[model samples]
Structures are given as structure tokens and as C-alpha cells.
Target: MIKVKGLTRAYGSFIAVDDISFECRPGTVTGFLGPNGAGKTTTMRVMVGLTPATHGDVTIGGLHYRDIPNPGRHVGVLLDASAQHAGRTGREVLEIGARTMGLPGVRVDEMLDLVSLDGREAKRRVRNYSLGMRQRLGIAHALLGDPSVLILDEPANGLDPAGIRWMRGLLKGYADQGGTVFLSSHLLHEVEQIADEMILIGNGRIVARGTRDELLRDATGGVFTTLVTALDNHQLAEALTERGLVVHQAGEGLRVTAEPVDVGRIAADKQIVLTDLRAGHEGGLEDLFLELTAETQRDVLPNDMSADEVRA
Candidate 1:
């Protein structure tokens, strides 16, 4: 439903977004992930024409957002959580959002209810709302137009665990109904739970993009961890080594990286009498994301520090 082709944006001599391309399919929630200053916001701005790209283009339903009539009705954007007027009540803020999109004023109230902000706080001024409340308000505004595409940056910021879960369900439901939802977030655990695919950027370039499973497979080569509990760890290790498999001692159990069935057969052949046999997999999205972005930072930063410093 959304396509970005070689999108590039530069600020003076520094490139805020490098040549990058990706697709957000319908009936799926594609996550936009990057470390700080990785051009996630810049890319989103360019996509919506909020910030002009130096090169390349992005389109929704095959038409540039700028070329579409009432683009607000076709795409709902929640980039800045503090974009609303501080003086406006929550309901009023949503009303303005609805009206701005040429939608009905009732949509404001309906969205407020839809986001579960109905009775108690609708009349309260936005300035009086807590950070979590403001997040909900931002989501309410994004949903006001009932647009088919949603581009949200940090929609879960300041939300409690329950609120985050609700947001996840809401986005999932939207995509399940064939809507396109592109969410940008720094929370790896959250993205791991909800996103069907992920696009990870660093130094303004897309370093990785694929399904979570695909990324794990690509970065880790289908590696699996086998934990073997046996009385003679040395014999089991020798048996596995004789089979040309790598083995390492981990606590009382020997950790072997090999096929699950192969490890079991080796233990049987060696008469290891395994009491506990467990299987594991390598790096999750969090691990792959870290590895990719870390390498990018090391290559891009002015000084040769570490990833933690770049993040700091």
C-alpha cells in the first residue's frame, strides 16, 4: 500500500536520509526502526511531503502523497505528539484534526471514544493531560480521518504497558481490515511482538529490511543452540567434535550449535544419557538490529567509539 523508492534527503552537506527503498504491504504492519538520528523521522517527513526529499519518491496507492487530493483523508500522520494546541481540549483537538481533514466534527468524538478516551477527560484541556493521555490524543487524531494508511512515529511513547498493548491491538486490527500501518519506534521488544516486517536504518541508510524470521535467518544462518546435560560432558564434547560440530562448555551442560536431531543422535551414540535436552535459536530482531546498526555507527560516526556512545 505504501512504496518508497530510493528516497534521499540531505541537510546541507550531511545526509539525513540516504538512498533507501522499501514497501509496506496491505494487511500487514511494517515497522520502521532505527537508532536515534537514523533518519526515521526524516524519511517519514519526506514520505508525507512534510520535508522535501533531495531525490527519489514515495507513493501511497501508486500516487505521490502531494499529488493526491485531500491527502489527509488518504493518509493519517501522527509524527509529533506535541503538534496539538496546548489550550485546546482533547475533544477540541480531535475536532480540529477531523475538520482539517474535511471530516465530520462527530468523527472527533467518535475517535475519542474509539481510542477509549470517552467520558472522563474529553472536555479537559490538552495541557492538563499527562504524557500518556497526550499519546492517546495523538492516536485519536490519527484515527479521526479513518484513513486507510497510518504513519505514526513513536505512538507508544509514554504509554503504559496496557496502553501499549492496546495500541498494538488497534494497529493489528486496522491492518487485519486491509489498512496499511507503518509505525516507527525505538522499542525493539514492542516491534518484535507486532510487526510482520521491519525496515532498520542507520546513518540514514536502510541497513536491513525483511521479516523478523528472515532477518534472524540471514544474520544467524539458521543456527540453533543445543544444551546437553550429561555426567561425562567431556565425552559428549569429544563425540560431537568427532562429528565435526562445534561445542562449548556452558555451566553443567555442554552448549552445542548444530542440528537438533544431529545433537540428539550424537548424545545417543556417545551414551551420554542426556537428562535434559533443550533447543535454542540465535539472535532475535533485537540482536540482528543491534548488530546491523552497531556496524553502521562504527562506520559512520566521526570518532571510532562504540555503539553505546553513538546511542548516547
Candidate 2:
């Protein structure tokens, strides 16, 4: 398990991570999420002892990363996929790591094959590998030692759809076999599918952390939005309102604060000539993610719309 309490990292007078506390438990995948400059990378760096924490502590199984013996055998980390020697082949990189970790040279072939890097690809120089291939090589390096815990940042950044699915299954199986996986990524959909728990950070602080369902429940405020559209859209809106359901204009349709079944039945009884009908999420992670982290974002749109406006 990984434990962090009151963790902070500062550079000169600039603070990158601020008093964040969380845990990545054994046998679970914890997704660390945030936008650019939200401190996700900094926190991971601190966890692996690449950057010293200005205050507080982060430990893996009750020991600081620096204190761990032959740390790669205990905690695998891949903060940057391109940090390897560009002139070296993928096989050579893994060979060095395997030797450093005291693993048999045969493990090199095993890892390359496990990550689906064929003999031809393995022999290619790291500089010639595309971003996706580099990512695969990096993951292979992380898993080469078969450590108890894995900490990776942006591991899915350059993967294709199939590659992403492959990675998801690999990590899921690893966790099922009792390994700890703490990874950070900007791929929210992938994270939503793979992560057992999630931590959201903004402006150097942890803003939210929980299972997807738990965060969605709290985000929607115990209600849901139903989208409805018909030949007579205005009439459909009125009928929904008369049924004691809150209705609001949602773009070309209407959004009702009720169940999809209720909307369907009401439309059927009213003979409203339904054109489109669907239930909004119980609470969407994307909406909550945007709402919670909007403050830390630097991008500005002249006509930026809120989640409600976008829903409309």
C-alpha cells in the first residue's frame, strides 16, 4: 500500500503540491487525475523520490522510497517514457534494467513479448520508436521486475484504442493478483473504466477522491436529468412540467429532472410524437470533472458555456 500525508513540494517560492493526503491500497488501481500543472506529475515524482517533499511524507509499505532495498524490485515507476537512452534499442534498455534488478537475461524476452513488442520491434532503437511504442516499452520496463506496487504517470498518453484496452486488462489482472497500481492520466474515459478509485487534483490540492459511483452520486445531488424531444417540443416540455417534473430548455430539446421511463410513459400517453428521448447520466464524471477543476484551468473561451448551458 502507498500512504501520503500532508505532502507538499516547493521549488524556490513556487509550490507544486500542497498538503495532499491519500492512499493507494494493495490490490486496487487508483487513478490520479488533473489538468496540466495540477501537480499530478509532481506528486508522483515525490512518491518515487525523484523530487523531495518539502514537508510531510509518502511511503510504500511503511518505508520511504529511498529506504526501500533495490526499490525497482519493490516499486516499479515510469514517470517519463522517453527518459531512456535514445541510442539504445528497446531490448537493450530492458536488459540493463533486468540486470540492475538481478533478473535473469531471459526475463528481457519475456517482458518484450508480454508487452507485445515483437523481436523486430525490440531490436529497433528507442529513438526510432513512435510515441505509442515508447509507451509500451516503458510499461514493459515497469512490469519487468514484477514489483508489488506500480506508479506510472500518463501511461496511456499515446496508446490507440486497442492498446488502451490491452493496458486496462493487464492492470486489472495485476491488481486481481494483489499488486498496487497508482497511475495518473488525462484519459478520463479510460480511467473511469479501469480505476477502482479516483483522486482529482486542482491547483496543487486534492479536490475530490472516491469511487466513480460515489463521486457521481454527490455530483448530481441525488437527482438525474432526462432529455426529451418531440414533434411539438414546447408541448412536451409543458406536459413534463405539468407532471410535477422540473423542465428546462436543453438546446433543441428539453431536460427533465426525472427518470427516462417516466418521460417515455408520459410521452406515450400524451401521443406527443416523440422524436428523441434519452436519460441523462445519474451524474456524469465529465461534468463534475469540468466543474470542479474549472478554476485551475488557464484556457479561456469568449463564449464559454457551463455544463448546464452545454447540456442545453
Candidate 3:
């Protein structure tokens, strides 16, 4: 288990991470999510003892990282995939890492296979590798010590579709095997699919933390949305209102808050020439996250859309 209390980091007059607290249980994948400058990297660094905290404590199994006996043996961290020697092969990097931690070279080879980079490419210099391959090398190195807790920052940054799928399964498998996985990522869809719980931070402070459904419920305020495209938006809106459904006009259609099945049945009964009728699938995580973490202040994650575009 990992526990953080009053965790904070400051640089001069700027607060990067502020009094954030959360506990990650054993045997679960917990996603740490936030906008770009929400201090995720800083927090991770503090957790691993790479950076000292300003005014808080972070512990692994009731012991601080630095106080733990052989911290590397209990915590495997993959913070920067780019922090590798370009001249060394992927296999060589892990071998060195393992040796530094008093682990055998065979453990390095095992990690290479575990990350699916055991083939000929593992022997090639890291300088010749692509972004995705480099990420795999980093994972392999992190797994060298056989730690029970894995802390990764943006593990999916450079992965292709197949690699991403493989990584998802691997992380899930680790949790199933009673390992605790704490990872940070910008991919909301992937987190929704894989994370058992999440901690959301904004402007250097934790704004929300809970199961995916719990966050969704809080963000939506229990309002439901449905899309109804009919030949007659006017008639549809009127009928829905008459039936005590909160209805409004959208683009070229009507959006209703009535039960989806009931709305469909109503349309069918009126013979309303429906063009497109569907219910919203719990507003996308991307949308809810954007709304919860307003873009007015600090740096946000590099979304595909610009701030102005997101606002529009």
C-alpha cells in the first residue's frame, strides 16, 4: 500500500504540488490524472525519493521510501523513458540497472521478455530505437528488481495500438497477481477502461479521486442526456415536454432527458420520422475532465484541442 499525507512541493514562490493526500490499496491499478502542470511528475518524484517534499510525507507499506530497506526492491519506477544511454543496447541498460540493485543479469533478460522486447531488437543500441521501443526498454529496466509496486508516468505515451493493448493487459495482470500499480497518463479512455480508481489533480492540488463511475456521477450532477434526431424537432420537443421530460433543441435535433427506451417508444407511437435516436453513454471522460479542470490557470495536459477550441 502507498499512503501520502500533506504531500507538497514548492519551487521558490511557486507551489507545484500542494497538500495532496490519498491511499492506494494493494492489488489494484490506480490512475493518477491531471492537466499537464498539475504536478504529477513532481508528486511521483517525491514518492520515489528523487525529490524531497516541501511539507508532507509519502510512504510505501507504512515506511517512507528513503527509510525502507532497499527501496528499489519494493518500488519499481519508470518516470522518464528517455533517461537512457543512447550508446547502450536495451538489454545492456537493464543489465546495468539490475547489477546496481544487486540483481542478476538473468533477471534483466527476463524483464526484456516480460515487456515483449526479447527479440533481436533488444540487442540493438537504444539510439537506433523508436519512441515506442524505448518505452519498452524503460519498462523492462523497471521490472528488473521484481518490485511489488510499479509507478509509471505516461507508460502509453509512444505506444502503437497493439503495444498499448499489450501494456494494458500486462498492467492488469500485475494487479491480478497482487501487485499495486500507480500510473499517470493523459489518456482518459484508456484510464476509464483499465483503472480501478483515479486521483484527479488540477493546479497542483487534488480536485477529485474515486472510482470512474463515482467521478462521473459527481461531474454530471445526475443529469442524463439523449440525442433525438427527428424530421420534426418542434413536435418532438413539445411531446417530450408534455410527457414531463426536460427537452431542448440541439443543432438540428432535440435532446431529451427522458428515459431512452421510453423516448424511443414515444417516438415510435407518434410515427415521428426519426433520423437518429440514441442515448448518451455517460458523457465522455475527456469532456468531464475538461469541465472539472478549468483552463483558466496553470498548464493543462496537451490535449488534441487548444484551450480556445475546447472552450468553443
Best by lDDT: 2
Give residue 137's error in model 3 in angstroms. Answer: 0.9
| Model 2 TM-score (2 dp) | 0.82
Q: lDDT of each structure?
A: 0.85, 0.90, 0.85
lDDT of 1 by residue, 1-312 (tens): 999999889989999999999999889999999887888999999888889989998999899888988877778889987777899899888777777778877777778877788677989988888888998998887777778999999899989999999999999999999999999987787986789998899889888888876877776677767777777788888999999998998888888888568888988876778777765553455677887788544336556687899789
Pairs in clash, predicted candidate 1: none
Number of the top-ranking candidate, with TM-score as the measure: 2
The 10-residue segment of model 2 with minimum total lDDT is 298-307
Q: Can you tell me which runs of candidate 2 are displaced by over 4 Å?
A: 225-279, 303-312
Over the stretch 200-221, how does candidate 2's per-residue lDDT look in tens digits? 9988998889998788777888
TM-score of each: 0.79, 0.82, 0.79
Question: How big is the positional error of residue 286 in model 2, measured in Å on the Cα after superposition?
Answer: 1.1
